[model samples]
Target: MPEKSERQLLPLADSDDRQDLRADCGSCFGLCCVALTFSKSSDFPVDKAAGTPCTNLRQDFRCGIHQKLRQKGYSGCTVYDCFGAGQKVSQATFGGTDWRQDPETARQMFDVFPVMRQLHELLWYLTEALTLPQTRPITAELRRALEKTERLTEGTPAAVAETDVAAHRADVNVLLLRTSDLVRADIRRKKKDRRGADLFGARLRGADLRGVTLRGACLIAADLRGADLRQTDLIGADFRDADLRGADLTGSIFLTQSQVNAAQGDAETKLPPFLARPTHWDRPGP
Candidate 1:
């Protein structure tokens, strides 16, 4: 890893309206710190159960080791992005009343957090789909799905918790699949279909992966250095500890920041204009 950084040459199209989709910890009630569970592993130093507050969580709903999470054996926290679900739950659904202020609603808030998180993640994908010129044929359907998901986020905590998230997710997945096909339709080369493949720790360095559908692929610790990933669909691919140094992922569809954050990359790695390079990439890995 090097201290130098890379910059995107072009601005992210339609990303100006996505400010709310990015997490705002300052306005959040630290729901992720208390609501999620973790197992002791390479990503975490200790095993913890759901609904238990992380040991590093401070009284003000901030991580005491926020600046040193990775060095302190909490790499899991560094990669976890709730996509702004925390602040929305804290400020809007609960009317700004934190779980601490109303202990009775703590369980409800915790339950609703995951539900809201799922909805927000869909919103993220839908928003990105709408930005693609190829998806213009189904843009109206995408907008309708986005609006319905957005409305779901604004429901009562109980309503949100009880939402048929799986049903809604299935409905949105249909549109997302169509969007993926539309985007990859222009590729001159025959694309690889590795959907849900188990390529864990597989050797694929410098591979030509353009226009491939790696959706839900388990790429944990896979060697992908210098691979060309332009136009690849990476919606739910797991990149934990994957080596992506020198990889080119520009124009890759449905790739999220959290996925990039989990992988090992260097300054030479090319990313979509919308994603920020993980700061830890500048430091030596543990």
Candidate 2:
């Protein structure tokens, strides 16, 4: 949410907060590290197959090398967010019966976790869409979608395992697209259109980028100082070495922690309060 929008909801903060969509690792069954496969890449140090737990994963579901993941070349784990699906599948969907306690159900538990995760991710976005007052035109539709998605998250294990998450995502995307159009209509003027463009090393300082869709764009090392990126869709955009000093991303959608961590930002950079400034971000050069 924009900082101003954050302030607007301060009174209703307790009621509307989406903390439920965030991972609660302690309550999780190590679903992410076990159910997701990783190969030898910049993210993971060694290859691990899906359904096999990472060596660092402990019996209690905590990562033994949690603090040293990045130092040990497991940078991927640090950026992963399960949207609170782990605990839901661990406790709610399976009625708190762990895979270890009931080994026969292990495979089904693993299968359901990812599906639930996808559902929760959609819920996270839909919940945020509801928060935007600028999207009042289709707020009622978003509410219905939210209720529908919420009910799906409560489905039985068999139903979750058989769910068509991509189809559901497509249904929700319609509302989100409308919301985007309504929000961006005002700033369409004097804005750059760089949707899906390869902007690697491009110099884009102080540009008007309100409502631009930079989805999946390679923005590696781009100079984006003081840019206006309100409501820009930045999902999957590579931000490694990209300078974000003094940029305003107040209402940008789909800007994740991993993307922010890969970029360069400073004290002057404005961001949504939910995203913490990367600990490794550079100090201003004198």
Candidate 3:
């Protein structure tokens, strides 16, 4: 973990506020660098086994190649976000003691990182659901889920490590799926079921894709400008090099920052407020 320091806690506006989901790297111990493994692929340049720190990790837990990560075939690192998990594990769970100093505690810290990551991810989605006007019928339940998941994230390393993330995910997923139906009910077009489909480089510009289940779909390099993607379940969908300019993803579910970062988009792209347009996404193409 990085050295512990004072971190400011922002006021939570409401149950829907996602301020807690933002990664606080400044206060984190570079858990992503030392805890997670990477493999040689199009996204990463080399194979890094679990429990081994990447060579680019700095003494202060910052990436030595951060600015040029994408240029150097470390695009995977550029897109990865811990969803505020790293800091929570470092500052709260372990009290800022890093693995380097307390070598014996390294394994437990690494174990807790992924569990906290999943819990935080759920918090992100639950908070997003609370913001949707169409999900008003389930807002109370979403709030309860959000609070419960948030509490789980704050548990001891042992408790977090033993959590049944899959079970909690299944429970929350039911509500998210229902939220999707409510949000896209008005889209009368034929709802596409592209689950696990290979739509790479497909020219889907201006297409009506509302209420679609694009789970695990490969959408790499697809031209989706001006497409209606409202209420789409984009879990595990690959968006590498996909054009999202002018596309409306207003009510999309389970979309993560990494997915948006891997795609191409611009100012006209309508996204959920929780996600930002990737800085590298200027005027875009492959």
Candidate 4:
């Protein structure tokens, strides 16, 4: 794909807190590289099993190709960030231990990474929402919800690891519904029963859109680069110009592999289908 534009890389409403979250990766034990898996596909050029450290992961818990992962057959690595969960588990939960010294803790640390990552991801969106003047109508409610979710991140690793993250996510969805009702009331009022309305050009960058019903909607030109689309119903939705770089579309229902292949994405996009990758990214000229 063309070198992603700055606008595309850092979508409107990008938060400095989110960038700060990424900067603390060195404090992490590289949980994502060791805990996740990949298949030989267009997105990742090798097969790696879960709990196996990626070959590019250096002994110091740094990526050997950190600056040029895409050029080294590890484009998937460019898109993967643990959202500070790695450090949270590595330092706070596991007390700065690596799997090499205490192998048994590895499983617990791995299990907790996804849980903490989800909460940190929410923190990213809520923090971004708090910065938008247009979204100020619901700022109080948003702040309250944000604090509540942040508290969840600080919970004991045992509690966080065992909690039903999906249920907690649903609870947060109720809060997001109130926020969306306040902000999207204008658009919602224009369309009678916008349970699944077309939202072309809707400036939803960095918005929390988890579990929203967007079936058959036209999402062209919609800045969704960092919006949470997990478990959302996206059957037949058009995604042209809908920046998905750095967005997580995992577990989303009805999003076909072919549709993603047809859409414009880049190295930062995280797709589902386990093994498929985008084929239509606009690559830069040689």
Candidate 5:
């Protein structure tokens, strides 16, 4: 397991890296709660539209159920953090003003979130690349990439917010591909290209599935407890009844929140960052 410091710097962990991404929440204007939307899913028990502040959000930009969200109906809140983008858009972009005060900038802030999220995700991966001793061969290149992404984070809110994130992501993806090839070449031999394969009820506990392409695979009822699912392409994979207890799904791309909410797990199940545990799991009532 990585140390806390390392975990904080890398968003590719089993938990969120908000503590290291940035700590300027006090400077934010609560952009997330006021800008994002959610449906009444197993993860979130209420229906919320975009641009509407969550009912639990306080006037001070804090959640009323910040401590007991799982007990309440907001288990999703516990896992969602803005990666300092909230504060960045609030203070840096809009000059520390709230949407209630300046409604005109609310749409811009909302539009910028998905862009910033992509950048932040890149930062997470680049930071992880910096820590791998195996990538010593391309450490300088990786460092350059990391520094470039860091510089993007420091840009003015307007500039960062208006950036062509898709183009930037393409460039970053190219670099990451090289890095992955260099560092994961040895372990690549065992990678299974099970893209779109039906894996229902497969006992894959503790499997070494690094770099495997399991895109669109039916993983229903699969025992994936303690599996190393890093860098696996899980796009459209069905996780119903999949025992993800203690599984490490860091860097698993294209996995959606809806899919996770539809799955079954318990406290013992480890999940990717930005995803909360299912609410009714192991509970008596539906």
Candidate 6:
């Protein structure tokens, strides 16, 4: 297992790094509660339309049921992470003037929120790639991309709303794919390429999946108990309701906190230090 310092590489917070890419809800205006929509499913209890504030949103822009979201049938909210875009849109983009103060601003702010979220998500990935020794060859390009993305996020609301986000994302994804390849290149024999594969509800308990590319794969409700997942690429993978109990994922790349929160785990799950064990997860078995 890597040391705590090594685990801290993902959400790197050095002076040279850009502003935090992690969600700081306190500095946000509950954008996720209003700018995004949800549907009645196992993840959400009620259907919601975009641009409307959630009933649980308080006047102070905080979730009324934040602490008990999962308990209150709002599991989707619990696992949702905006990568700090909420605060960026609330404080930086809008200069701390909330949507309620101006109807036009409300519409524009909501429009820009999702765009900024995607930029910030890309920043998070580029920043992580810079922290890895494997990506040293592409460090210059990664840093350039990170700076470019940061600049894009700082644009005016109109500029942000009009950003060619899909085009930008396509460019950044090329770099991310390279980073993934560099990191996983030396992991023994040819690894499984399950990218975007549908493995929902598949039984994979105690499987050896080292250095595998599980990007965009659907592992929802899959049994991953005690699986060896080190060195795996988990970017965009869906782990909702998957059992991660006792799984070894210490060296996994691109595994975000939201993905981990949506899964089930236990104390025995060997995760990187940067990733916290979900509180709702069961305690280690005796």
The residue pairs that clash in candidate 5, if any, are none
TM-score of 6: 0.91
Question: Top lDDT: which candidate number?
Answer: 1
Candidate 1 per-residue lDDT, tens place, 75-121, comes to: 99999999889998999888889988899999999999999999999
Q: Which candidate achieves the best TM-score against the true structure?
A: 1
Model 2 C-alpha lDDT per residue in residues 1-286, reported as the tens digit of each score: 1111132222121334667777788888899989999999887889999999999989988999987787898877877778889988988888888888998989999999989988888877777777776777777788788878878878899999999999999999888777666767777666666667889999999987888878779998899999988888776688877999899988887676668877888888888777778765654432
Q: What are the clash counts of all predictions, listed in order?
A: 0, 0, 3, 4, 0, 0
TM-score of 2: 0.87
TM-score of 5: 0.68
lDDT of 1: 0.88
* Per-candidate TM-score against the hidden true structure: 0.93, 0.87, 0.88, 0.62, 0.68, 0.91
Ranking by lDDT: 1, 6, 3, 2, 5, 4
Candidate 5: what lDDT? 0.67
Per-residue lDDT tens digits for candidate 3, residues 1-286, read 3211222212232334555567888888889987888889999989998888899889888889888888899988878888889888988898888888898999999999988998888877776677677778877787778767877877788999999999999999888777767766776358767889999999999998888888889999999999998878898799998989999998687798989998888889998776888888763444
In candidate 6, what are the lDDT values of residues 206-247, reduced to their tens digit? 999998999999999999999999989999999998999899
Candidate 3 residue runs with Cα over 4 Å from true position: 1-15, 283-286
Clashing pairs in 6: none
How does candidate 3 fare on TM-score?
0.88
- Candidate 1, run of 10 with poorest lDDT: 1-10
Prediction 3 global C-alpha lDDT: 0.81
Candidate 4 — which residues are off by over 4 angstroms? 1-20, 134-137, 187-286
Model 6 residue 58 distance off true place after TM-score fit, in angstroms: 0.9
lDDT for position 281 in model 1: 93
* Per-model lDDT: 0.88, 0.79, 0.81, 0.65, 0.67, 0.85
Better of 3 and 4 by lDDT: 3
Deviating ranges (above 4 Å) for candidate 5: 1-19, 22-27, 194-202, 210-222, 228-242, 246-286
